[model samples]
Target: MPYVVTRSCCADASCVLACPVNCIHPAPGEPGFGTAEMLYVDPRTCVDCGACTTACPVDALKPHTKLGEGELPFLELNAGYYRRNPHADRTPMYVVPRRRSVPEGELSVAVVGAGPAGMFAADELLRHPGVSVTVHDRLPTPYGLARAGVAPDHQDTKQVTRLFGAIESQPGFRYRLGVEVGTDLTHADLLAEHHAVLYAVGAATDRRLGIEGEDLRGSVSATDFVGWYNGHPDRAHDDHPLDTERAVVIGNGNVALDVARILTADPGTLARTDISDRALAALRAGRVREVVLLGRRGPAQAAFTVPELLALSALKDVDVLVEGWPDGLDPDTSEKTRLLADLAARTPAGGRRRIVLRFLTSPVRLTGDTSVRALEITPTELYEDEDGTVRARPTGGDTQTLETGLVLRSVGYRARPVPGLPFDEASATVPHEHGRVGPGVYVAGWIKRGPTGFIGTNKTCAQETVASLLDDFAAGRLTGPARVVRTRTQALDLDAWRAIDRAERAAGEAQGRPRVKFTDAESLLGAARAARTART
Candidate 1:
């Protein structure tokens, strides 16, 4: 049997290079690689040598026979890709891009944001012999979404940080944590110290639903809700009320599924994960039993990827149900629709906790007093345009009221305007031509493209930005700094970050869980300082 790519696939394409038979479809340069949900292994050609498994950062590859009940679906998912989209005339091996020659004299780059995009860009730049990178972030810790945005239970997904750690170990890489680029050190200041400044600052704000009573006390954005559970320092102190029997989440994206899963998952199971202590306690004490996810369109137009939906179906002791599924919808339309059709056919296991996948619905208003008490939702009708595009509009029928105390808005995310950077209001992104904003100024990640694609999609995005920066440097468009720039903010260095890491691990070891994250700036800094004092 061949190896199968599972849900945890990060789409970094590292495994694509390791396959001796070149069985992985949609290699880096191939079509759909950037937007693919997960890379699939061609079972027919796979030698089962496990080379791809060794190269995978997230351990997303598994032997076919060793697959668990939950992972068995992926076997067909991988093979189905080959059946639907065969790659017969493709190159036998991936053609590696020619390495660009390093420009004369040493080159320095300032990468703003220690997230995946910034780290990937830094890694790309450091490939050149004479390149050096200084990464800066507002947080004391690094790995923005990987650490704080990924759900705690998905430990496999979190393993990508190990790759980031390897990038940090590179000789020319350094971090200036706790320093905000626009505020603490201006873009001009960085330009004076480095040859170029690359902004990987991701979308920082959640898109709001323009409805009545959205500002009620019990209502919150899924971004903040995920942050609260994931130990994000900014949301560490946030209070989420879960004292109701049913909680309503508005939206059908992957983040919506994440918050719903976390809300309904058994507290005993969550305790073993790296969830914030406060969130775990609140969940244990809360009375929430059912989470209803509202989708404005039908199953065909659902925004979440198939992998996330599969994970939702596999949750232990939780019943996944489909509500308000439209009539005449074909079950064979797509994998997601087929799965939903199967879910709609199943009998509920009568589990105490359940997640309702409600379709063809839109929240017209959030009915509440000072706090969220109920939600008024309207049915929606989906229509197809001449261009084959599907959209939803209110049906103008009777509205139903759902009594719930908590309402999480998971509509989407938008990029906030960075100080001193030109932003396009319509797209909520920085204005740039192929990642170039101006001379010595560039952008990557969600800030470059709008918030779309998977985590590894940023790799190709960063590679393009780095290529542009290198081309400018080779053409003498970049000028060396006139003077050295200095900042008075006390920034955390590599050693300090390592110290915090050690402390978190040690504390988690005592609790028989993964590392207990420091959810506040003071505790993180204190751990670093204590370690520094001990060395002295």
Candidate 2:
């Protein structure tokens, strides 16, 4: 049976390494690898060695025969991408070279943020002998978005945590959780104690709609909504009033699809998922029946990934409808555009819940007195510039008002400035050239390049930053660790995290779920302490 990539694929691309025939589309170094929504196994070329199944961090690879009814759609979903070009050129499987160890003396690096970037950096740094890595994150949780931002229903994507766990289990690797670098310890402290410090803190804030009435009670960002559902301690208690019968989401990105899916999904269906208990309860009590995802551009410019759109379309009782198709559609298309056209061609089944995908519309204002009551949108025109770039221009001829109680802006994400780091206001990123911010200081991931690309994108990003740091060390630009006293911070290490992980899994076991997460610092830290005591 051919193996298929499923909804939970984190896009980490580990499966590509195990594929002997390079059957997976968009493997690293390939043309579209960076932007691909998910790596696809070419069924036509798949040897069914089951190598990818073992290599996948999220266990996203599954044989056709063993897939559940809900998962069977992915088999076709994977195949459909290749249907257009079945005989696409294939290359030898790319092999990541083993990193050579640092020469001269002992190397100790501090990586801030335990997200994909930081974890991958640590893994790369550890490949060198006589090197040790210490990771730090402000939150009690180890992984950032991988733990708190991924949709709970995507259990497979969440499995990338296992890869991180493996990295953490490596010798000379440690993490300090619940410790804010700038607040708890100065940047100089880390610089003093380590040869270098790599900042991998990802883009944390969402781009705002910046429209009138945006501050209305029901106006929320997709970032918070994702965080809330994934049991992010900071947003778990948010009062996301899902009291609206119909909601308007501004943007056509994957995040917008995620929000629409969460809003319209049956709460009973979410119960078995790893969604937060409070979020589950709120969703169950919610009356939301319809969601309209608005895109300021045409279907050709829609920002959502094809896989996400496929998942949205596959929703059992939810209708996926599209509006605003241009009379003469452009012949030029991408995989995303082709899938969107297919969705537009299909008729809705008149399901109880609906997700309407509207194109060439931009939300001009949020209309309401107390809470969001409606969204005023202006129609847009798409034009190609001399450079062949498609741009959206607002047209005044038509305006529409959507009676939506809730409005979610899912435009994009911005990296917040770290207190002690040099930042570029224009890009909302740390000032860096090839990941090196300064001597003995570097950056990786979204904070370094602004939020773009998939999770595996960070691995390449981290590799670049590490290469720079290693070059600096080899050049003797970084002399040595400063001779300064380091203050002790009450932080949790990998063991503490494992303890908390076990406790959460134990708690989830009784609930018949994957894991019941601790959504607060107190409970999470307390569990860690208890685990530490037990270990002693």
Candidate 3:
């Protein structure tokens, strides 16, 4: 039986490397690699080695024989991918080149943000023998988004942390937890101490709806909600009012789906996952039974990926209801369009909890006396722009109001400007030419290109940034740390983080979960200090 890539897959492409036969299509640098929602295995080229199962960080792959009911659709999904992309080159195995070590003298680099991008950049830098890398994150814990941004139920995706752990164990790799670059150490300070500074600091804020009553008591950003449920220190104590029976999410992206699923999903099911105890308790006590996702465009133009829609469709406990598919909307033209059309075709299962995917509707204002008690939305019409792009235009005739106490906006994320770095207001990204922001200054990930693409997308991003940095180094550009500034706070290293990891795992072992993270810097540092004391 062939292994199938499933809904949880984030397209990390780890399995692509592990496959000896190179049956996996659209590997990095291959055509269609960037746009693919998820990688698929060719059932025709079957060899049941099961190497993919171990490599997949999200447990995205499963043998056809052992496919569960929820995952069964993936079998057909995987097969259909090959059928659709018959012309795709699957014969040639793409082998990653071995990185050569630096010839002489130590090269020390500082990477800000311990998320996927920063970690991957550090991993790349560590490949060179004479390179020493230090990662700095404001949060107490490393693996920024891997720890807090990824959904709690996606434990398999969290498995990427193990790989990061291996990178951490490598000689010359270090980290500074609870250290903000601008506040704690200036860019000049980092430049003074390291050959270069690569900022992978991710987008910390969300795009706003900009409608009235956005600051209402019940309104929250998906970023904050995701962070809260995943034990982000800043959002651990967020007071999200979940007393309403019906809620509205003002976007149809994967994050919106994630928030809707979490709200409607049985708290008991979430309890088994790594969801924070506080958020779990809130969910358990929540009265929300219906979540309505509002999309300004039609189903075909949804920003959500096909895998997320498939996962949403398979939720056993929640009924997914699709509303407002415009008549004569043409045939299924793309994979995402096909999946969305399929969603439109399914009859609601009439489950107690429901998630409504409302299309062609745009929010105008949130009306309430003191807080959000109702949402005013207007119908929108689709029109082709001069550039042949389909765009949504507000019809301005019909207006509908939905009574919902809670509103979570999931429009998108915007990169916050670093204090000392050059910023581009248009893209909300640091201005750079091929990842080189300035002399001996670099960037990668969301901060470099705005918040977009999957986790594996960062691998290429970091590679490009590192390539530019290395090119500069060869030209004798990066000379050493420019200046060293003494700071009151100590920068935590890998050993200290390992101690924290051990402590968290031990705590989880007692609690019967993967890991019980220390939410705040104070607690995390306390654990690290205690671990250090024990070691001494």
Evaluated with lDDT, which candidate comes out highest? 1
RMSD of each: 1.4, 2.4, 1.9
Shift of residue 396 alpha carbon in model 2, Å: 0.7
lDDT ranking, best first: 1, 3, 2
Pairs clashing in candidate 2? Answer: 8-157
| Candidate 3 residue-wise lDDT, 220-240, digit = tens | 899999999998999987888
Per-residue lDDT over 305-384 for candidate 1, one digit per residue giving the tens place of the 0 to 100 score: 98898888877688999988788988999998998898889889895699999999999898877999999999999898
For candidate 1, the per-residue lDDT at 517 reads 91
- How many steric overlaps are in each model, in order? 0, 1, 7
Please give each candidate's TM-score: 0.98, 0.93, 0.95
TM-score of the candidate numbered 1? 0.98
Q: Please provide, for model 2 over 1-536, each residue's C-alpha lDDT reduced to its tens digit, 9 standing for 90 to 100.
A: 38998753556567887788889877675666666667788888899889898987777788998887667768777887788646467765767676667653478888999999899899888877778888999887888888887888777777888888889988889888889888888788898988999999999999997899999999999898889899898899998778889988899888888888988888888888889999999998999999998888888788877667777777788888889886688534666666677778877777489999999888889888898888899888889999999988898767788887888889999999987789898899998989999988999999999988876678878878988988888788885777643435688877788888998899888988989999988899888898679778
TM-score of model 3 (CA atoms): 0.95
Output the TM-score of candidate 2.
0.93
Query: Model 2, residue 339: what's the lDDT?
Result: 68
